[model samples]
Target: MGRNTRKRSTLANRAIVASAALILGGGGLVAVNFYASAGEGWSSGPRTQRAENAGQQVSTIDCPEVANELPREMPRQARGEVDRELAAIDSQITDAYKKFADQKEQIQRDPQLAENAILNPLKDKRQASIDRITNAIGRGGNKPQGMNNLAPCSLRDDGNDQGDGQNQGDNQDGNQDQGQDGGQDQGGNDQGQDNGGQDQGQDNGGQDGGQDNGGQAGNGPQDDDFVDIQSIEPNVDEPQEGNDASTGSFATDCGVNENGKFNPDNVIVAPGVANGAHHMHDYVGNQANDAFASDDDLANGDTTCQNQGDKSTYYWPVLRLQNGQNENDANADGGGNDQNVGEIQQPSEVTLNFVGNPVSKVTAMPRFLRIITGDAKAFTNGDANANASWSCTGFEDRQLKDKYPICPEGSQVVRSFKFQSCWDGQNIDSANHRTHVAFANEDGECGDGFQAIPQLVQRIVYDVPPGPGFAVDSFPEQLHKPITDHGDFINVFDDNVMDELVDCINNGQKCQ
Candidate 1:
């Protein structure tokens, strides 16, 4: 999908039309209301009925994305204030999500409680934050209009959408092939069948405390969330190349956070704000990454990258096992405090490769350029920005966007991202932090004003037990759903190193 299209205005219509609500932003995972999973809408009874009867459980709070509604350009001075206000809205949502989850049963019995207790209070808080945002923008830029529509949020109900838990909102058709076919004739590669007596049944009464507790670690990664990789058909089709394609790749070895650099802050999205992410992140490369690290601090900071010239920062939400256990941050912000409880799993392999665009010569990425791939709020936000790819080591060709991969025994689970490669040739960042860069079209060509750059492809593999027991850390409201997985990167390469990288790609030579 192209940029600047937010699925906000029609919330009321979508809610009424489809029995289930349509959550927008990030990797979109749409819960259903027993509607036609990908097509027909669910019909509902009176709003006063029990939630289960009216629809189903409340999936999440659906607030319009205030950031999406802001003016594209704003005064640099007020940017910080607006960013803080945006972060405040996130905190408010996190707090309200906690309250909603705490009183789910009460809300279910008396549906109005969700409106009175959760949505109403959340709307008030968001309204105040949006007011501050408009004021900040008015100081320099055209104050954004339509912000009033962003404050009022509604509840998205849940069901086994598709009866198999597939999100219907990512693509326009609502009918996604999904690559989930239960056909396997991999000969010796049929490891999923070769495994011993590990039941692959959808419902085996997960660990001691599972969905009964309500999520991966008490908030999600439900039984429907995991799909065996072997059942999926091959769907990865590399884009075609032009005759003069810069068909080369460059690799960077930044050991997967071997030193355990962890935090719950998003320096690019929520700078100077503590716990802005409300979820833990495992970082590699730049060690100076935090909520308050400035450009100067990052430039002078030590890096984990073996190549000292590459001081770039790369981080993403941590993956965790849902088995009853707690990490050190179990009681800390972005951790247990935010309902992200689990044993964090360390990646067994992390590969950072920068590949060239297939249709043109690659250019250097500007210093301090930040790139975020995938959407962290995918569960609540639609898949407009979701770029997550999940699969197993042997079955990389078949990647899943909505369901978690249940890797076969002896095979490792893989989470990968191929970041945006087209740059606008002007700003290193955008107000939305995304419009500055765009992904190449299916033809491998950049959009009109964008230029080709070395595309960063990250692949992180984990040797967790082959089952649905593991899930990634996510914001509490995100329900620890796989669709919410995301990755972040900040380019801090020196000019010399940057030039070499561009040359390597343009000359069709693989370099390290």
Candidate 2:
């Protein structure tokens, strides 16, 4: 009732009001923060998780189990699609070749500025074509229907019915073992689950004008779809003999090893069933995971889509195409390590060998060796002797001290490269995990086909020449027979190899 009493009461009431306002604002902020965090997690569940894992220094995901069996042939429709795509690709490539030939002819006639300039333009076009085709095929192409966008399967369907309705007889033993233990708790309809409900199983026929037409998704590569073989004129007459024999068909040439092994495990090649590299794409496939309304939908027919994840699975490492012309044994000079060899080349190699009793014609001989690496500098480097950061940030084994993750510091990961079209157990088997080879290139973009390549379906990893623990004599003899003595295969990791690879870059070389 007094002036003092009224003033004190007014002040106290204002303080209380301010306190309540503060609490409400604070609560609102907290609520919004919580919602934002949850929304982000939900929106980027697979992608963010992959990126985080990428930066992580440790690898918790178990190495993929190798599938010993060859992939069944592509379904007729899929094969047909590939055929069409490849045909178009071939047309483009052929045009490029024609242009290249014309340029070469011009060079033969003029032997001057025209040769230098004209060859470069054609070469760029060729390299672009090669890159486009290689990426398209290797990444399963961009055709909407036939193309699987590297998605994983939904509910981890155990039905081994690849796109075809028929069962492919329960995939691999490893997969079967996993299925038995619920390792792949593919929560969905079990085989022979009660089908008493609704007498009519719905038939959602194929979409009008679907690419499959009426073809069933068969088990493997189509009979008619031929993989392209691009290389110099291969010498069939001079067959590789003994362990020293090399078919000269390496898909990816990382480097040569001075003291490499013949074992397939030590060597790197294409995918095989046993070592788990074969089915890596199953999880990373365009059809990794997908949702279906009913079991009938799956039975009706649908290409499997891999589940959401880093879909960059099948991208062959960045390959550095080797120029067959330059063969300088970096180990030839004074028995010291030849730092000049393959220094500018990029992408470290992973091993995949498919040697099945009845190997897939697709696996006949590796046509394309996908070299993948994380070297940021491989493409940028000008010198051949400088160190190439052939380290994929996420994949490299960084625990080692020398920084080079694939091979040890002093010793290099030299793969004793060889190719055997023969179905011999002595060579790489799509079944045995041993046949896949792994090597390191100095650069990141090897698959472009613009660089100088060393050999064929085989890639040879090497140490700087004068390999690891070599005596003096090891250098010269190893130089003469790099592929034989398991010594560094002679190819300039120096200016010469780079110069040749650069020529490839500037002048697109067609597959012979």
Candidate 3:
């Protein structure tokens, strides 16, 4: 979504406050109630047909009829009460928005490349505000104790009345339809293709490759097409399931490969072990030192607070860098009521870059796909270290390197083999840097029957090398090996996908 569009949601909340008075009057209140009913069905309060129609469809926008009935001014006492309550709601919403703006400013200033899992709850709070404002305006009768004095009650009633008006319109339309069966018959004929088109079809249902027979060109197999076709090859050598291919002729560290999708269920996590650091983030000392130290703390379990991190510094997950008090924006607090904090400088604590590009920092974006089990949430990632921050505690003796150095204690670095297909510039960068599996606990849904949170994800990342006709799409499949520590199996779609991949590689049908 564009930034402008995202900002509109905030403006919507402000509109609720402005329209409160018009929404509270008798007709407006009824309109609001119609749109804000909690669920389906109605109670035996009144026998009016209007009430029945008001139960269908709720809209947060537009209440012209309700506006006509609202009083020009409420009593002084009632006005004061409304003002105070509105102010409180406004304050709460503003505070939330401030934090969010601050975070947004902080992210643009940071330089690290680790993805952060924080800031998620704040975004959720913003969405809840929208729902609250809408719901408040819909239920004005018998206001709740704390929120009773607000103008939202008046607006809510307006929604109910509007719904009733719409129902009346629908009934009129229905009456018109009852008087004309001719229109309905024509509409049905247009909806279904069985009327006049019947003559275009043949009586026999035999497949003749005819257009009218529901078989179009380029769809089914052809008679002469299979003249040279042969049966698919049968597997003559089948190793036990989960077994890796035989040792290679040479000691190779990296290659490209295609197999199955990554599935978290097959993941077998070894005990926590330290993986060597990749200079994914730029800079060794200076400003980025603290961020690195913070990361070390999390890895070593030094910070014991559950769901809490080094609160002293706010880390911009996007840059995986630290921000000082002044560098952070004051508006990103997740509510739309705060003043916007424009571009701010990167905090002194954040000084790293990924691949020389600041934007390459792997700040953990909110997951578009997630699975939550009970109170736990799980998600997957392909770029694991984009938003990592480290602290000073473990930096003294730690040696920085990319990939796991010794495969931490209790962890075994097993190998698997499959087909190789390196199309598009598959070998451009670290050929070994292919993504296969990832499971995370940021949101919770541990694997089935297993208490450990589960998240599985995999994707192929490659670029076509510079050439006249070379492009990502032009790249062909090649044989390669991609390994990941997050999950046991890289391909989750089918366990046997790897088998076919390996066969394709051995037959030289794919990449080498």
Candidate 4:
């Protein structure tokens, strides 16, 4: 136990201290890494793992079966005549929609602008179309019963007059009627019943308000008592203006068939309701497309578009201008239940265009991108819930809040949409069918950390003869309201075609 033993013991102790430091430091480093990663916008977890299998490359296509049956139900002779006459009417309607769309912003700003710039000309054209249809059917009147029943907007009532509590239009003024409990008016006029009461002179009797003042006094319960109006926080990142930036682009005529028929295959309606969209859709690109078409079906089918190699299938519901019946009657019983129910006409043309990213060169688009623009429930839910642009072909600057835009002379109504192009580089869709991809920046660049692909620009042109007579044939729940009109698309490109598309975008070359 001399100098040599003491040196060995000191060395062993030093080794133990060094080992302990290393273990403790390693544990702290691991914890630091976890928190740092989470704070680095990885809270949702690693993009690859979190986004894996979040979307499907293929979506089922199912057009409604009812749409196909309506045309066949008409007597052959009458069908041919009605179709011919309706075509003439549709042309006039198309012109009217275009003009209205061009001045949509002005019209919305001033009802006078709508009357002069849109309503007047549209009424004349619509009347002529109706006359021709009536003549073809051997009806002998300047204003046929069908046309009279479905009067033009200018000729019809505002629909605000509610004879009883049972019949009432929307409160256009946004002011609820004053009555017992702040409900309808006590008298038959000035807005119907009160306090949710259907009768004319029902007393409030301490239900909502302490008592009724016989249809007088305080406008009943104040709106603030039960309703909380919350102000939506503005999205700091929301673009204040439209983005016009684009790199390369491609165009395709995907809305019509070789015979120029507006026939799109059905896909999904309300998530799981396949073929539930009770209207016709025009399909192009993939010949094997149907309501239940699969990715393999799309890839293998012959394409109608210019680039036969790119087999992406695009489709949308056909916008029909009702000829004779109200929307409720037309869509009642089943869309195709009767020959005299309503006439469903096709569009003169449909166009589909694809524009690429302005900044990064597009890599290959992930196969099978399914996107739905505009809400089919917009009629009931309102335009605020819709994601569609209604405008005119020439006047692209003006946008409309309603689903259909009435056009002025020399213009065409157009429904245009630009789909999200930035991809997470993994999933084809997300839980919302939108999170897997995002809209490009205001400068037309992809979001940070996401890859850019070709932006889908879909333009659907419709010639709805101007007048109140026109309405879309929709699901029973939708009541065939024109505002419920919407569009959907699904991409089903072959691997080779997708690669070529990617190369074209990356190289900034315009393609077809």
Per-candidate TM-score against the hidden true structure: 0.81, 0.18, 0.15, 0.47
Per-residue C-alpha lDDT of model 3 across residues 273-357, encoded as one tens digit per residue:
1111110111111121221233233233322112222111111111110011111222222101111111121122221110100
Q: In candidate 2, what are the lDDT values of residues 388-502, reduced to their tens digit?
A: 2222223222111111112223433322122222221122222222123222122111112122233222222333211111111111111111111111111112243333333
Reference-based lDDT, residue 510, model 2: 23
Q: Write the per-residue lDDT of candidate 1 for residues 186-282, one digit (tens) a residue.
A: 1110101101112223233222112222223345555445556776768877777888799888899999877878889999999999999998899
* Cα lDDT computed for each candidate against the true fold: 0.69, 0.20, 0.17, 0.40
How many clashes (backbone N, Cα, C below 3 Å) per candidate?
Answer: 8, 105, 92, 24
Candidate 3: residue 346 Cα off by (Å): 9.5
The TM-score between candidate 1 and the true structure equals 0.81
What value of lDDT does candidate 4 attain over all alpha carbons? 0.40
Instruction: Evaluate residue 442 in candidate 1 and report its C-alpha lDDT on the 0 to 100 scale.
Output: 73
lDDT, candidate 4, 1-512, per-residue tens: 00011111000110101001111111121100111111232011211111222211100111111111122123334433444434333333334433543443344334476567655665665566555555544432232244532214331111211123221111111111010111211110111112112122334311211112222111111111111001111111223222433356666655455433232224332222233343445555676666456666666778777766667766655443322222222322223321112334445566776766654566667677776555454433333224455555565554443323344445656666566677788766442334456666565556666777777777666554321223344432233333345556667766777776666655557876
Error of 3 at 422 (Å): 28
**Candidate 1 residue 441 C-alpha distance from true site, Å:** 0.7
Q: Where is model 1 poorest over a 10-residue stretch in terms of lDDT?
A: 185-194
